[model samples]
Target: MCTQPAQTEEHDVSTQEENLSETDTALKSIIADVLGLEAATVNEFTPETGLFGHLPELDSMAVAGLLTEMEDRLGFIIEDDDVDGEMLETYGGLLEFAHTKRVEA
Candidate 1:
């Protein structure tokens, strides 16, 4: 019953960029949420921070949950083969993963 006017492809691309920024922010937020960690705590999450070593909250199950949230929220599927423990090891790596998705999209 409700329809909006179509946008130009350029407009759509701009919207997608905004959405990607939102996704990055949401990724951090969801990481904190799923990890049951304070936002500030995740501010400390860097690529070399040792996700598994540093965060006791991050285990196999949590990893699965995080991946699910990412897939659901960002509209991008994370293939199992696309990542490994090393990629989740730090904030930089996580950023890299997100960047990869944007590039792939």
Candidate 2:
């Protein structure tokens, strides 16, 4: 009988971490491009980095543009109801949201 090796949990976790890293990179790039911020400044964003209320560059109009860019670049549809202050509150939140939407798509 022929059999294939089963996937290991370690391998799965490593792949997941890699995907998260890629998602993080993409999100940061999108944010930088949309807000016209330096890539280095955006690269400095941490999970706790406040986005909406804190960043003067991230106004309501900018949010709309940002989301549109995200949808185009990330290949996902963000519904009107999916938007909220919390999702745009921090880099981590938006990263998580993007990851979830991409996986779902």
Candidate 3:
């Protein structure tokens, strides 16, 4: 009889964690490039890192450009209603949004 290796819950969780980390790094790089900020600055962003009104570089005009760049780079579309303050409130919020879009795509 032939048998296949069974994946454990721990393995699934670990894989998900790794994917989240990769997504976070990719999102940070995209944000830095779109906002014309240094990659190091984006790398320093944490969950509490405020965006939108908090970042001078991320003004209203820049928001449109950033969303366009994100769609181009991340292969996802942001609906008009999806463009909201909460999604851009903090680094974690943005990352979570990106991850959700990616999964949907």
TM-score of each candidate structure, all chains considered together: 0.70, 0.86, 0.81
Residues 5-91, candidate 1: write the lDDT tens digits. 576767867876886567667778989898888988876665566665567888889988988888787667888798786778776
Where in model 2 is the C-alpha error above 4 Å? 1-8
Predicted candidate 3 versus true structure: per-residue lDDT over 11-100, tens digit per residue: 756876786888898888878887788999889999999999998988888888878888987888999999889999999998898877
Best by lDDT: 2
Per-residue lDDT of 3-60 in model 2, one digit per residue for the tens?
Answer: 3346676776687688789889999999989888899999999999999998898889
Local distance difference test, per candidate? 0.75, 0.89, 0.84
Model 3 quality (TM-score): 0.81
In model 3, pairs of residues that clash are none
Looking at model 1, report the run of 10 residues with the lowest lDDT sum.
1-10
Error of 2 at 91 (Å): 0.8
| Model 1 / residue 10 / CA error / Å | 14
